[model samples]
Target chain A: MNLYVKQTRSISFVPKSILAVLILSFFIQCFWHFTFTNFVAKRHALPEPPKASFIRLASLDDSVSAAKLLMLWLQAFDNQPGVSIPLKELNYDRVIQWMNLILEVDNKIQYPLLAAIRFYAEVQDEEKQRKMIAYVSNKFIEKPNERWATMAHAVYMAKHRVKDVALALDIAKLIRQYAKGDNVPYWAKQMEIFILEDMGELESAKIIIGGLLESGELQDAHQRKFLGQRLEEIEQRQKKGE
Target chain B: MNHNLLLTIAKYSIWEAIRDKFLIFILLGFITLFCISLFIGELAITEGLQMQSAILGSTLRLFSVFTMGLFVITSMVREFNDKGFELILSHPVPRSSYYFGKFCGFSVAALIISFMSFCCLCFYAPVNMSLLWSFSLFCELLIIIALSLLCLFSFNSITISFSVVTAFYILSRSIEAIQLISDSPIVASGSFSYKFINSMLDVIAYIIPDIYKFTQTDWLVYLPDVKTDILIVVSQTLIYVSLISCVALFDLYRKEL
Candidate 1:
């Protein structure tokens, strides 16, 4: 009876051995999460914000769940170990598929459109880049901010990498037509100037800046001063060329 | 609905859920994730609230759905394995009462757990919008649980029931996306094959409720009161759950225990 009592007493509120194992497991998991998992996450950080789909879904109508799934697929695709693969061998067909998936859900989303353009540009696939730019131009014709930002980025890429002034100028003209608002930021106006200067169209740069300054839309004193300096610099350069 | 019988069953189900060590595990996991969100918030520095709301809202929604599904299927399997359902049916209990009871039980259990998690969030980073999302999420989980019970009755095997129910939940979530592919220009203007695919997706779109509308965590960060939207969500859940329960009841009536 005493032995039985002693044996029962040994097992108190909780067993000591089980408590030790639980404590040890907690520390082990903490170490693993802080070290191993953290290291891997840092090595392969997501290029785009992860919950962008959830935000878009909240903001958009219908087809939002489809957008979420496509975002998940994009994240998974980006997380692939493709870094070791030769740059030339990196096929952009998957990128196109992911873009189409996102666009299919909500064509208004600028993130996927921008992502497609950047991915194709990175791989130096001018064909895919042109295709993406054309798609964005046609589909987002009404969304001026989205259209201008995307097309401007495309124009910048074209002038430097592809050396295609025609493509750059075409995008610039679209910007001129649709991106008209008092709210249009100065950076967008600068993009057109940058494209023209890159194409040696200093005359167009002078005219665009003159129009911007005259409109009084560059309301901030700093903006007005910056535009005045740029116009003067362009005039000096144009005269120097003559 | 048979209120008394329903209450009894639901009370029993809540008791079972409370006694479940698995539910405790899930609660612990939720708390851990919330802590991690706070840690991430610290790292973000400036946009800490936005980050915490997004992470906590999404994590809670996903984990709660998973917990509800696992709990329903496991409980059903245990009852079946032990001939517990047979013993209950051997009494004066009507099949509908038993079925409704199980649904009520699971919903209450889910409500309690979700409410507790919401309180935990309040302790860390309180937001009125989080409560709205959590409430809608509870409704969504209730609908999922009802559908799960239907699946459990339809398919005798727990594995098949769990898979089919989970698959159904996933498909419901992605139905909008499936419709998008079908309605794409290529499909709309393409050959007979594409039209046929589009037609099938149209039918599916009609069948599955658009759950994306209810599970939006974006509002948790931006909006103060999406009360009208939450009302619509709860009403939709009631209609869906009722339809699903009716089908489950019909199936259970015909089923040989």
Candidate 2:
């Protein structure tokens, strides 16, 4: 009788035991959760802001070559191991495909569509570049800001790809006229003056450079020294001609 | 007269839920998860926003399905197993009030838990300081809680209720994938058994509320320009909850002690 009573008592304590176990398990789970989370946080250090890459696309000829070269450049851009791959890289092929797809349906836009314009400038196909610029200028006469990208493309086409100093100067002036005040970067203004100097428009270049020096925006010692040296060189060239 | 008795019962039921250790533990767990997510967000140098959004969204969805489902099943089962319903019905409280009171208690507990969890998420996730997201999250939480409670009340066994709810959660999460699977050429080419399985999955996807619809953590994370219509989504959630709760209430009223 005593033995049976003892067994019964032990059996009665089973529910209490189970309850205790559940509570202990819950606490242990909580502890593990926090510990694991903190461990992961400590393991991966925050990454640095990525450096931007500049690619000059003015040397290729055919659309296929342009597409292939763009893809190659994009692969290099997107090869960042820890950081996010650049959008320019990931969307490169997508942009090319979109151009092909759109061209299949309609090719009648007065301005070469966005994709064709980009491809033409990138590959430095002079005829295609001229057509795109003319089309853009005619079609987007009212929306200058929208045409800013194409204007930049024109500058690239004239200077780096086609080597047309006069046309580059013309496009640079247009860029200066459109990108005024807070909309423009100071470096862009400097680039405009450089283009004018390259085109032998020395007087206009000197005025722009003098204005830049007065504005105090070009205050960095290295930039000031470089601009001063370039100005001296241009003045020496003109004096020699005189 | 019986309404007052039901109100008192409901009041006590809510108090009981407040004291539940399980709910408290779940809240703690969720808070920890949110904090961890913030730390993880700091590591993502480039796609930090998108990563944060994905983590927060998936975490909230998982928390809803797991924690809320467990609370509903256990609480409902305990009430039946402990014969607490008999004690309440024996009082001056009407049977209708007793049942309604229990539902209200569970609903309120779920609401409070959801609200607390949402607040924690907002604090941790890099969301823009928009009151709209918080309010929308609250509404979604209520619907999820109500859905869970309905599943619990529909089944006799707590284990079965839990199983059904888990299955529902899985189906809801994978509804798009399931649809794609059904439409795949491989499935089409397979035997009759594969086709039948795919058809069954499609029926489940159609029948169940895709809980994924309520998840807006991604938007909060990404801070996208698009704005979601809150009123329409809330109304849809309310309709689903009301329909389920009504069925559960009718069944509960007819159930014998």
Candidate 3:
């Protein structure tokens, strides 16, 4: 009777030991998660630079000499080397600084601003990339020439770098609105379909491809063939799911 | 005396290899990888040309080595492991005829797979219609398969088949590096281990065919001025493949079945 009692006590002890270990592991995991979330939150909450004070050179009266000086100063501030140097030797921060100056002076110089957006995206700086993209979009709304460049840059940034599906779709819609005659608009639509397919919105992608095929706009043999193949692939995928 | 029967057996061997399930699986896997590559290609917005070339080049290398290695090893090993050779020998088929037939069969299958892969890439990716470079890449894949089969049947062991083929691939890639390292005076004057390593590398380079010679995809995709001499690369590939296949057949015939 006494030995049986002792065996029961040992068996109960095993469960207690396991429970203690589980509790210890749970606490450790929670601690790490708390620390990581706090670190990321604190970093994201930091103040951004004043966007309005940067130079605004939207007019012809802004002297050519003054623009040139501002460009030089921005290069120095951003630490970018002169254009003559090979790209490998160029400083990224200097490129961003010059881009900021261009954005400040003439919001119409979309390429430099796009370069700044690209630099931020490359570094995986999501906050800065987002800020730059938003600023460009606002400028694009006011100016007409920057439309194509803005849409293209946003498509690249959202789809590849940031991987923001909603933003990519919005940019695609914006391209269609702004770019009417050019091939860029069609390419943007294709990119949207691709993004939709990637995101598992098969029905939406099929509808888009079907509409393109039926619209008569894809008159070229090559483009038609490509669309046909893509639609067939999507249909096959859907059938398999069924 | 029975030449017709020998030819029949050889024909059957070729058919069996073409219908191999493992080879089909490898081809399907390669297709999936190619599709994935298009997604990865999007990341090359900054350095478009260089990145595209790298992605395509690496994709070709990966599929060629992996598919060729798997097909060659599995085909050779199964003949021994499954005792399929006994069935062939039970008939009136000459051993040499069987070996040659198997080699030819594998060669055809490898060619078809390589061509299909090239076509798929051409259709899917932004490929230029440069016949010479495309043909050269196909020939290169054939040569790689031929070398792998030669090494595989020579060893007659699946484990050795994989090891030797992988070794050949690495050696082929290292040829230029080996040459550079061998000519370095500092290395020549270094410790025993360093000298020994360099000497070993030199020996490997001499023994292995430089497979990198066949890689012309980058020039085709990137540089407009670069054009491959189609006839030269094709002839070189054929000569190398014939030599390796002949050696492999001789080895197979001499083995005690």
As for lDDT, the candidate ahead, 1 or 3, is: 1
Error of 2 at B80 (Å): 1.1
Over 4 Å off, model 3: A1-242, B1-14, B47-50, B90-92, B124-134, B181-196, B224-232
Categorize the docking of model 3: incorrect
Model 3 residue pairs with clashes? A55-A104, A57-A105, A78-A94, A79-A94, A80-A94
Of the two candidates 1 and 2, the one with more favorable TM-score, higher being better, is 1
Relative to the real complex, the DockQ score for model 1 comes to 0.06
Which is the leading candidate under lDDT?
Answer: 1
Please rank every candidate by lDDT, starting with the best: 1, 3, 2
Pairs that collide, model 2 = A57-A122
Superposed on the true chain A, the predicted chain A of model 2 yields a TM-score of 0.42
Stretch of 10 with least lDDT, candidate 1 chain A: A1-10
lDDT of 2 by residue, B54-114 (tens): 4554565567557766776787678778887677666666666765666677667666665
List lDDT for all candidates, in order: 0.70, 0.57, 0.59
Candidate order by TM-score, decreasing, is: 1, 2, 3
Query: Each prediction's TM-score against the native?
Result: 0.60, 0.52, 0.49
Sliding window of 10 residues with minimal summed lDDT for model 2 chain A: A52-61
